[model samples]
Target chain A: MKSVKAFAPATVANVSCGFDILGFAIDAMGDYVEVFRKEEPGLKVISIEDDGGKLPWEVEKNTCAVAIQAMLDDYGQEIGMDIALKKGLPLGSGMGSSAASAVAALVAANRLLGDPYERKDLLPFAIVAEKAACGAGHADNVAPSLLGGFVLIRDYHPLDVIKLHVPDSLYCTLLHPHFQLNTSDSRSVLRDAIPLKHSTIQSGNVAGFVSGLYQEDYELISRSMRDVIAEPYRAVLIPGFYEVREALKAAGALGMGISGSGPTLFALSKGAEKSKEIAKAAEEIYQNIGLGVDVYYSAINTRGAYVLEENK
Target chain B: MKSVKAFAPATVANVSCGFDILGFAIDAMGDYVEVFRKEEPGLKVISIEDDGGKLPWEVEKNTCAVAIQAMLDDYGQEIGMDIALKKGLPLGSGMGSSAASAVAALVAANRLLGDPYERKDLLPFAIVAEKAACGAGHADNVAPSLLGGFVLIRDYHPLDVIKLHVPDSLYCTLLHPHFQLNTSDSRSVLRDAIPLKHSTIQSGNVAGFVSGLYQEDYELISRSMRDVIAEPYRAVLIPGFYEVREALKAAGALGMGISGSGPTLFALSKGAEKSKEIAKAAEEIYQNIGLGVDVYYSAINTRGAYVLEENK
Candidate 1:
């Protein structure tokens, strides 16, 4: 595989209570990229499309370019690569749009370089690239884009990453309100202090969700995913957040919460049919609020990052 | 199988960062009780001993009696039984003294009642009984005593419980300094509100520990068991806590933290040699503080509440 093309799917971080540490991939929505090895000695940005004149093309500001540069820097081989990114997921949409691009570029670059780097080795580079784009080093988006399934960013220092088995019965319905919420702005709006009791409650939910994944207890997992700290405060910024969640719950959705930084809300359900119902209900709720909405029904992607296609 | 007597070991709650949600059993360091059916219309507290007259004999004030009564009240059965308490772990030692009595009595009673109820079925009863003793309904202790191993009490409502596999290479060393830190008093000292940044850090540690347990990464588990929110503030009351933890860590102990509330400190290690070293170092630290100390080395108890000896 001298040169290859890959698609890294967009992801939902925070999965309710698991902020900064937990994430899952969405298969249908993602970014596509292509890479080709060059005899020259430096990573070169070939082209970018569908960014709506928003993303930067510079090596420092471009997520794909930064990721490839980091990988080349780590490998100590100044092998050059021509990369192209077609951004499919919307930018700054709380849907891991940048992470998908960074992951896809790094994965394609790693393949172009005779597979010199392991997939896990690419996480930090992707995180760094994401940091350059979002101005924060959060693994919740990058981990899922890189490793698939439900990835737990155990510790960022030594980078302890664990792939969790998502239950087959679990399905997600994402409602993107067609609004942008910058991760930095959302983070800044959050309170600098939280009640200790609220923190304890959130921790309990996180533990329960992780354990529920292990036990395949959907009921427990849903009950445990409630977030009292970040979501309660962040939801204030997202229109129809509470109404959508309550409507979905009333419509038999198991659990619901803001996906990552907000403006994008997700509901967890027991099956595809229920997930569809949830999506329909969420779209209606958003429409009632006079906002455009894009809804996707997806299952937990077990495969993390992978090469979708290759060219000779 | 006509009659049975069982002993449920005591537990240490709040296992560091896992406040109100995590606990583990201590081997041979708990209350012992026996239960046998009698041909009577109501439950009876037959006898109590070795409790230093600290506990009440009235059924309402007795932890064991109240627990059994809750079960009886729920079932509305005319079953009667005799309960004997052999208090081995001292009261008010931050060692879950009340949880032990509740668990042992419930286990014995359940067995005497032909074991009709599942262990989880008895959790709410035990928690309610615990509230009668401690004035709060918390499961950090009761869950471990009932389930064994390291337990994460994810939620009280609908009961989200996750039991992580305890690694065999791990040894628990508990050092109880001669002092009393009432759970309520210790709880009162805590600031009702905490800085949100600190809570986020603590939540990260919780996520790291849970992920570590799932991956069976012992080093990460030890590194991630840190408690920044509660430990610093609470450790001030426990004399020499800082010195003991420092010495143990210096002597190659994996990690150390206040066992439950305070006064009793615990450490985790891989080898028996290191566990002994930690215990010895802790003893020296406590001695330097002019406090009496008792140390115990044990592994995670997989068998939670069980019958110890049956009277044929």
Candidate 2:
């Protein structure tokens, strides 16, 4: 195929208690990328469709460019491609915006290259692209966006990934505050070291949270939802964070926390009715603090990145 | 009922990846305690029938005394009781020796009191007794001993416990080195602070480990079987821990790790035949180092602590 188009769904990483290891895809918004073959033997960014916004146009600085370049190097192929990006998610809103672009581009490029590798085989390339957008090469966001459903990055050295289970009754409500907190600054606010006691508690929560998901126990999930490592320090970056969490809880959210890194807050519930209440409560709290927020309610996204169209 | 007798099983804590949070009961051996009610309003240790070894006869210093005392205080009863103890496991062997005694005593006392509460209602008293032994209150040892099977203590403040699933085919092989390491001394060897990077990696392992148990994925469990927090520091205290671990791995054991702190090393296999081979390999390694060791084999204990006899 000479041209291909793909869509990559947005993913929510960290999942309250699981810090850097857990993530799940959300269906509200995502990014779309198109790749077209060219005679010029290099990757190029044709356009970035946004609302009068400017991003790095240089191929070396863009997420999709770096990821595709890495994949080409590994496959030992030199092919020219022009890429276009359409941002359906707000940049730096903590909804895995960067990861969506990187994943969508890789999926598109793979199709344009005649599908040399399987879908799961493209994670390494996607992760390298994520590193270009953020400083660290974390797969929590990318894996779910690429593979769909709930996913766990068990280890990073060899890039191990495990697809996790999520119940059908579970629903999510995300409130994105109309402000920006980029990935680098969001990560910088966290402490490098933590007490052993805190880590133990965090580990306990991680175990309980994952076990709860498998058992379809909502109460267990609510009780296990906690973050002592980064949430305490990063709470100050988002305005009205504490009050919003309290409101979310008061509205009967099974669990709630910062959705990726900040600017976006998410609460989970066992049903759609409670999910709507959680979103309304959070939005009202943000409005009371003189801030406008965009709310998105969704069931867990089962489909991840996918090829939209291909032409030979 | 004027008298009640109960037996509490031995518990293996930590389970490699989850420190201070995960544990499971073993069927090989346990502690037996009997409580006889009297008209006099005081709790006392009347007899400790062991291998001619004397324990503290005083109530304040003993874990069984502290646990039963707490239970009595909560019940608002000052009934006098004569308590007899029988130790089936060695002390400081990392088999949760002290926890077995405490859990047995609590179960016996509750039975004698006409079953004032359910099985799980006794965790607080059991945990208070564990504090007397470890100097810090933890339920990883006591919960599994009291509730049976695999249990996860998600939080300590409110005492949240979640029972995890264990595959029916999984069996345990433990080699207790002929040495002792006190809980406090084992804890003292560990550092108070950990880098966030290590904790994140550890969290991944914890998530994977629990998920593996529920899915019956032995390969995932083995891959996630790692201890970055306590094992490295405490291994120095055990004489041939590294060589024994290597031997366990060489013998095709699914996973091998410290039983709680040190000295006792446990390996897991899918069935009894492979379990015996794992035990043999570990024992052979310790014998080559000129050290004598005690070995035990068991399937995961489904029944935790139980009333042996209820004399009404």
Q: Give the TM-score of candidate 2.
A: 0.95
- The whole-model lDDT of each prediction reads 0.82, 0.89
Per-candidate iRMSD:
1.8, 0.6
What lDDT is obtained when candidate 2 is compared to the true structure? 0.89
Query: Top TM-score: which candidate number?
Result: 2
Candidate 1 per-residue lDDT, tens place, A100-194, comes to 99999989888876688878888999989988988888888998998888887766677767787688888888888877787777888778777
Off by over 4 Å in 2: A37-41, B39-41
Score candidate 1 by lDDT.
0.82
DockQ of each: 0.57, 0.88
- Candidate 1, residues B1-312, lDDT tens digits: the string is 245666777677887778778898867577888877777766667778888888887888889989999998887787877777888788877778888899989888887777789988898899989899988888888889888888988776667677876777767888888777877777777888888766766777777677666667777778777887788889888877777888889877778888778677888887777888888887777778788998887776777888786654
Best by lDDT: 2
User: Model 2: per-residue lDDT, tens digit, B24-110?
Assistant: 999989999999998888889988876257467789977888999999999997889989999998887888988999999999999
